[model samples]
Target: MSDERRSLHTENVELQRRLEGLTPLLAEKETKLIKLEQEIEILNNKLKQQIKEIENLKINLEEKLKENLKQKSEGERIEQRFKLNIETLNNELEEREFFEKVFLKIISILKSPELTETKIKSEQREASYRREEHERYQRVIDELNEQLQQTNERFERLERERNELEIKIDELRQKNDILEMELELAHDKMSQQQETSRTLEEKQRELHLQEKEHRSAQVRAQRELEALQSLSQSLANENKGLREERADLEERIGELTEMLNIRENRVKRAAELINEFLERYRLTSGRLKQQIGRQAEDCEEFDRLIQKLRQMPIPKPGLVQNLRICGRPGVPRLEK
Candidate 1:
């Protein structure tokens, strides 16, 4: 009985030792799980921040698009105004050309002696008729002068309005330039955010893989722990089984360690892949920046052309002369 008590006491000591060893392994696994959870939480926070930044970028892009649309509409309105002004100027030119032609026709009629002589009789009769015709011509000249004055006033008014419109156009151009700069800044920020998001995605994928590995390790560890518990229960009932089961548990632990090493190697390989991807991304970004620079240059050239068009001088009205006619001795003479 004493020998049996000593054997039982020894078995209890062995079980206690085994339990103590398992306690540390369980504690280490718990620490790893807690650390993984913390890492996952941190990644989640980072992802949330990235999502928020992306949303903000989207909002800014939408606003920029709206501003661009507004500017386009304003430009169209300005173009329409310019067209209308041009049409008004053309109509005024046509009216002036018509008046010039009419004046020339009147001068031709006065210069024709055959037409005047046919209408006139003797010199005394011609003189009285010529004086009456001169009064009528003077009245027509006064009327034409009044019309010319009104036309000049209208032209001056149009010129003033055109100057005002040009000032507005200049202001609009300044605003457009400001908007363009803002858009460039926004685009740069968006590019930066995209790069950050890509980095985050790679990190998230890595974390996911790590988490999956950890869960697998945890499941393997749990199974091993269950086996250890069963073996411990069997060893409590049968002393001969303890050594063999312990050896098996030690071998399983070694295998788990090897798997851990393999997992770590896989993580290193994933990191290398991430580095390669980043290198490719950097090359692509450089090319994109170069293309953006070329596009900016083209846009600047287009703006310059638009500015040149805006600065183009408007055609002014030409001066018109009063009609004068000189006739033969038998005919009447008219002067302006």
Candidate 2:
């Protein structure tokens, strides 16, 4: 009985020692949990900021897209107007060519002396009519010259407008290139953010698991503490049979301690890994932020470039000479 009481007392002392050791470990775990929670809160705040940034980026992209669509529509309208002007000019050129051919034919007929030699009264009458026709031709030639001058002026105006449109088109193309580059950068940033979010989610999940495990361990420790308290309360009455039971309980406690040590090591390793991941994430996020800032600057520069392009002067078309239709006096103009 004395030996059994001594063993029981020793078991109680060892249990107390283990309980004291576990208390500090639990406290340390609680400290770590709180620290982790604080860190998670910080990460959450960062995530929220990142989300806001993404939203702003989306808004900017939408505005840029709308601007691009508006520009494209305007460009199309300009192109259609240019096409109509070119067709009108082509038709005018064709009309001028036809009039030139007619003029050449009239001159050729006038140069044919055989018509004068025919000596028929009809021929003489025809000759008189031909002289009248020549005077009418002179009037027609003067009208053609006036028309030509007007057409030349119109052509010059159209050419100047076309040149201006071409310059605008080239500038639009450059803007498109800049927009495409900006879009690519935005896409890259979005991808990076997504990747970072995924990493954060994974880390959050790991933290949740660790919290669960810690809670379970805390519950188990509480249960063990309660059992030890009950055993202590019943020690006087049950001391005879408790020798073997105390040895088994001590063995179990040792096993629990070993398990806890293993768990602590695992927790340490997990914490190290988490810290490493956080460091990497921090570096990556910093780089992404810098990139985003640079992209914003680039966008601003692109806008400035667009404004400069808009302010640039367009080239004007010079006047072109009219097609000469009259020949030297008494000579026929040859049609090529």
Candidate 3:
């Protein structure tokens, strides 16, 4: 019985030692569970912060997109307005040309008489002069045509530039669309989060930076649009002034042409008067020649008559008695 009791006591002691070892192991497991829970909480907080940051980024992106769209619209409106003004200027130029052509025709007709006296030697010379005048007129027409062509080309180029700008705007719109989709997904993810930090201060800082950049971009775009508008306005004013100057030059040219025509006509009339005077002098010279011939004949007859009178003898008393005796005595001289 004693041996049995001793064996039972030794087994009891061994069991107590094993129980004590198990107690420390259980305590360690509990500690690990608590640590794991704390780690999970930390990870959850970090995930919430990331989601909030993503949401804020999305908002900034949307605002920037809207700003860009607004800028693009304004630019388009300005471009359209500029194009309309250019068209108006072109129309004015066309009208001015029409009036100038009519004035030139009138001047040409008024000056035709001056050209009539030119000694065009042959049909070829006449044709050549006509051709030269025609070529000069053609040159003026060609220059006007060239100006019109250049204007048209400029208009076309501007239109193409506008098209390119539109295309760029479309591309920006597409990018914004994609960014919006991404932003939507991020918002959905944030909504699913179980917990989130109230003060997204770090995210707000990022958003503020983005907002600042977007605003700066907007200001730049606005300035560019304003500059373009100013350029268009200045161009329109310059074009109008140029048109006025052109009109004035045309008027001056027309007046000078008319004056030249008047001078040419006066010169032609003076030449005709001179020719008439020359003919009158020639007729007077012919009459003087006939009178000189008649006077020469009269002088010859007077000289012969004077010579016959001188040859006749001087009448004396004896001469008279001899002449009477020579005549027959029956002459009735008995009264003597």
lDDT of 2: 0.47
Q: Write the per-residue lDDT of candidate 2 for residues 51-152, one digit (tens) a residue.
A: 555555555556655655565565566556555655665565566566656755765577556754543555457556655755665565566556555655
TM-score of 1: 0.33
How well is each residue in 1-336 modelled by candidate 3, as lDDT tens digits?
223323433343343445445556556555554555565565556555555655555555555556555555555565565556556655655665665566556555655555544422333564565567556655655665565556556555555555555565566556556655655555544443312222333344554565455445434533443453354345435434544555534443344334434433443443343334334532343343333244333323323333432354444434433432122221111111
Candidate 2 vs 3: which has more TM-score: 2
- Clashes (backbone N, CA, C under 3 Å), per candidate, total 0, 0, 0
Better of 1 and 2 by TM-score: 1
Q: Mind giving the per-residue lDDT tens digits that candidate 1 earns over 1-336? A: 223323433443444445455556556555555555555565555555555555555565566556555655655665566556556655755765676567557656775676565434443464565457556655655665565556556555555554554555565456556555555555555565556555555655654565455445434533443453354334333323322444533443344334434433443443343334334532343343333344334334333433442353432223113323344432222233
RMSD of 3: 76.3
Question: lDDT values of the candidates?
Answer: 0.47, 0.47, 0.46
Pairs with backbone N, CA or C atoms under 3 Å apart (clashes), candidate 1? none
